[model samples]
Target chain A: MANKVLVLGEVREGALRNVSFEAIAAAKQIADGEVVGVLLGDSVANLAGELIAYGADRVVTVEHPHLKSYTSDGYSQAFLAVCEQEKPEGIILGHTSLGKDLSPKLASRLNSGLISDVTEIEGAGEDAVFIRPIYSGKAFEKVKIKEGIVFATIRPNNIKPLEKNASLTGDVASISVDVQNLRTIIKDVVRKASTGVDLSEAKIVVAGGRGVKSAEGFEPLKELANLLGGAVGASRGACDADYCDYSLQIGQTGKVVTPDLYIAAGISGAIQHLAGMSNSKVIVAINKDPEANIFKVADYGIVGDLFEVVPMLIEEFKALKVNS
Target chain B: MNIFVLVKRTFDTEEKIVISNGKIQEDGAEFIINPYDEYAIEEAIQVRDAKGGKVTVLTIGGEDAEKQLRTALAMGADEAVLINTEDDLDELDQYSAAYILAEYLKDKEVDLILAGNVAIDGGTGQVGPRVADLLGINYVTTITDLEIDGTNVKIVRDIEGDSEIIETSLPLLVTAQQGLNEPRYPSLPGIMKAKKKPLAELELDDLDIDEDDVEVKIEIVDIYLPPQKAAGRVLEGELSQQVKELVNLLHSEAKVV
Candidate 1:
């Protein structure tokens, strides 16, 4: 009999995060038997059909009130139960904030090996090898499970999601686990996140730096990001300069992103800032300083004041969108 | 109130990675306390100061790691511990690292534990949460702010770009985020004091564990740097012409538009 693979379909704001489908897609590439999708939330049974259509052979939902907001205690209890019951040969989850926090605990509890932030997978079934970024994407390491179950976390936007096949559907089963003694309780969630696309998952990002002189300086970057339907980010210099909140910071000690198009405006790229975004697919730099390090990593560079270049580029992008 | 901070010595982020023989060459690499752990140590010190307790800095490495531990002590940690795994294990993974740390901690009187959100070298933010799971305690990762009153604690953790306020209690573990606190440098007086501070070193044999107990589960098949994106074209012209050229290039060559 072939081994069964379990895919954790992570839900956020009532919908399954895109990385969930990407994980299911990854599980399909590795599964020799049935690929099971597991959903955990207070009300997530309704989201199971999409997982099935995306490639899950079956869906399991663990519903409990305490599971609504993510607490390691509650989620681990619920997921561990499904793992024991199903005895899955493999487990896959998204390497998001939730996955990063949850997977290690689950992997530890199961006494299983975990390959995290995997950007690529090779081979199939037990022979599969996982490729993950080490040293903050400075280097790549190809790892494999020497023994025991295959457990891994895929970085968001790195892997491709399987296309939906509406003709494909499966049964969605519900299970209950006793969730108590949670040492941590969420009091509230304060959202300072920009209403724009999630930066990590965004296809394009317009990032600013110290040259963005003031808090109001980010407004133009935000406008450019909005025009491109992308997200706005900042270098630590900009964040440190108080031009923007630390939430928008990207660099060595900040969020690492691999957006399709990273437009760096007025940012003299430091190695620290480059550490977070050097992996971006197509980097474009608009800086007045021709000698800026950002130009070295960029696919294209424009030497000019960002105040003038950004607006002109935004207009040009607008025209291109119209023509398309 | 007894606080513990987990520290690891890692390559400085500024250093260019030099890999040879499929392994990161560390012969002369400058190492420092993992930057995020500095935040953890700072937080531990502040928590200890306010709540009337001592902070113990703990790390799992060889004798060389004692320098980082002493640095933590100089930053105000009450004591330091170095679990010398050099002779016992050739390589350490997150699983074994967590297992050994948990085993050592399982017997201690721990009121609070802290660690960096992620190590700069490994870049895996797993040890703190895994240790917490092994010890069967609650944990919050990437915490930006923490408040404690009696046995109750409130934390603000960074979830991507947003914040989640959580209520928890001791004994709890939290992984420090970047903005958690400003880590203090070791003062000359503090450095002198750290010389007298206790730094307890132990080995796997002392912990009653062997090679098979906490074996590494994941095997690294290969290690190499990603192909660096070569420097591309730098457009030159009037502002408007440059904008037009960039748009054309993004569309025709890049196709990312």
Candidate 2:
């Protein structure tokens, strides 16, 4: 029998993020018998019942007042202690900023190998192979880890989350964590404050570029995004020129996203920008320029000014929703 | 602040990669400084210019890596150091390589050490932080913005869809992300100066690093090209028909819609 696969559950404000369930779904395909999920945080222990519903045979809860707020040292030390006890074959972590900080430290301490930002996983018996992009998402590399223990940090929105089972059961084990010895402290955290939608996890995204003309030009695109219940993204050009916030920029030099539906509004997609979001399920490009490279990959392209087309799209979506 | 920027010579991403057996085949690909490291070198030069100090660009690669060293010099680094070892640097694991560099830097009065967040070639963002941990200096990765005021450094990191600001003391190790600064091209005079500037060559034995200090943990069993793309379907007929066909293909075949 092989070692059980473990997933590090990620949650914010009590609700589980999509990446947590996706990690479990991925673990199920790779592990033979049991898939264990580890939940860390205060008052986050109750989420374990939800974890079993997502397909975990066991849930390890690390409950500490210090764990309530994420400190790099606390999380790493706690996770390291968990690995010491469980001795699982592999651990899965989401490739968010937190995971990026925690994974390498954990891998270093365990003397284990980590495959970062993995897009796919395949397992045959005890051998689990991971596929990830290299050269800044220009190409993909499949790495086989045949060492002591394997660790992987998966990119969010890349994997599909499994449906909730609702009939599963699992034991919740709590591990104690010490609060002292955390070196780097986060002085301040500034959130965007808008609850419109999380672009990072959204299945659908409508992106604008410099071609949108001005900040006001984004209004129709925002309406379209709202109608679709998605988030609005932007190209580097749009962000650099102050057409939108830098948070929305998507490119090799910016945020990498892979959504189910990616609609480009007046965006002459540069290759660097495309490299980030090219893995999207369906790309619909709307630009007046017929020669835009975005049309090369777009499943449906509209060659017209976004000002004319986007408003019609919002109106059409509203009518369709009302009719349905 | 006296800064040192570490760079690696890697294959350009523009070239089509060909992998054979378990290694990346370099039959016809032209290698250059990993693109992200350029940002680190640029930031180092900027710091030196502002603070009135020298910036040294260091690398542990083959003789041909000198071009990238000269490029770094041309970009405004005052000096260059190359650990001219016979070992294939790509084959040499990062721990051993960083250990060698750390041993070398112990002698220099380095106030700051900068590196690319991750080498595009290896795609491992481990070296900077791992080296920091080994040296026991504070390490900050994925730094989008950096400010040096006296000795206190302000590092702005992009967290989960947000930014976290952290303040730490100097003599720190930072891994710079893209957009930290725009890299400068070598001026004609800068290129001429690079030619005259001395780039010292050293051996693995020259450095005081102990061989046993570097513990190699990870072994890459194999590396291969990703699967080939299937031929894409072109929806033909009228605009509405094409849209309908594309929608069907997306919802049913892709299954992600």
Candidate 3:
């Protein structure tokens, strides 16, 4: 049976988030019929062309006054309406804060199954299997929907977006939605000071652990991250020690990140911490301890004081960039 | 006020997992009440203590899970319940788990229910909200702070790097996040009291849920360890030399530069 998979495009700060394109890429694998992108928010119609360029075959825009900001109730109601109208066989969304909050409600309302934070997809058609980290990335599980609409939220940065084709065009249809009786209202969204890149979506991440010593120890890591156009993260040790905020903690209890390149500075690889970043394409560990667990998972291990090593690498990177 | 906390038995976060024949090896693995769920249990105890209520911890698992339920009780819960599904069901997914939980909770006078933001083993973070949806109540996840005053609830929920303040009525559910509070260790007296606390073991038949109605909607196809990365190349020499060599490798081999 041909499956029309709906890709939910996420918009943040008047722009399409990278995960929107990544979800479209994931949808392509299971979509045998049409890859339809569903955009819900005020003034989202303009983003349809971007979704199409990233691989959506068609776009459905749900615009309403109440839909301007994200509330679980509003998005759920709008998304449920789209699902009912389109009758999609599958729905793919980014495993983001918005998606995490909305997907479960929608799934329950639709009485469907959902696999969250899926990192890989194998096979295709009705038998499409999803690979997700379970036991906190210590192990992986392959799961399949038994019946009803197939719903999944892909972890960002894991799925590469399809090649963009500017020539590709798709029909954009606007639908009116009634988003009322919301129990929760988003009066405002206070984002953390824009740190250039989203930690979860950054291509490269420079993370620190307790060995960073103090809050000031993060300065070098931050500088290196900023230079590389990446993000800075911390281990639970650092967060617990008050070296950094819990928001930057990456571990079993914190955010799970999988970047193209992961730099663990002064982080001893606890299983909890590894659960968050072990899947990074290439791991580089810089620690004074040669036997640090982080080295077990790293592709390159530098047994030296990160304070001395990080500054040196920063200079070399600067020179390398200038030469290039 | 009647407070309920949903707990799960998961592998200790520090345990090194071993997969044999496509399944996690659990013969000697240590099982603990999920660390996140401990936050829920502690929060439930605090809420009950602050505002006159009885805290009851619940779990849907085998008899072995009684150990975890006991731990919750030892942490100050007034009662515990184990909905044993060991014999009736071979597999339990989030949907089925939520269905069973909702069925059990639907008739109860639930003022507030708490659970972890996500279980480490499954990490779906779906059960609490799914149960809320089924019971037609307001719910929130990743809550860092929760305050209740005579049916009016105020909460601060974690959203990525930021936080959101939400106000809702009672008869609510919230999943506990890491920053919610530091969970307390069970005292010797609390452990002794937990031994005599009401620990009821029920089954699917007791909940009046038919086997077919609560069937799992998803199937696990395989379980395996992630492919191991090749051993790391340790750069030998002084700090400066290692940094120089590391940058060279990043540029020439890793191509990350």
| Per-residue lDDT of model 1, residues B1-257, tens digit only | 98899999998878778899989998998899999999999999999888898899999999999999989999889999999999889888899999999989998979899999989778879999999988877889999999999989999999988899999888899999988887999999999999999999999999998889878998999999989787699987677998999999989989988
Candidate 3 positional error at A129, Å: 1.4
**lDDT per residue (tens digit) for residues A32-113 in model 2:** 7788899887778889988889898899988877676665667877887788778888788888766777777777667666
Query: Which candidate, 1 or 2, has the higher lDDT?
Result: 1
- lDDT of residue A224 for candidate 3: 95
Weakest 10 consecutive residues of candidate 2 chain B by summed lDDT: B226-235
- Superposed model 3: Cα runs more than 4 Å off: A193-196
RMSD of 3: 1.4
Stretches of candidate 1 exceeding 4 Å from the true structure: none
- Interface RMSD after interface superposition, model 1: 1.0
How much is the lDDT of residue A227 in candidate 3?
93
Error of 3 at A107 (Å): 1.1
Q: What is the DockQ of each candidate?
A: 0.83, 0.37, 0.72
Kindly indicate the candidate among 1 and 3 with the higher DockQ: 1
Docking class of 1: high
Rank the models by DockQ, top first. Answer: 1, 3, 2
Which prediction has more favorable TM-score, 1 or 3?
1
| C-alpha RMSD values across all candidates | 1.3, 3.5, 1.4
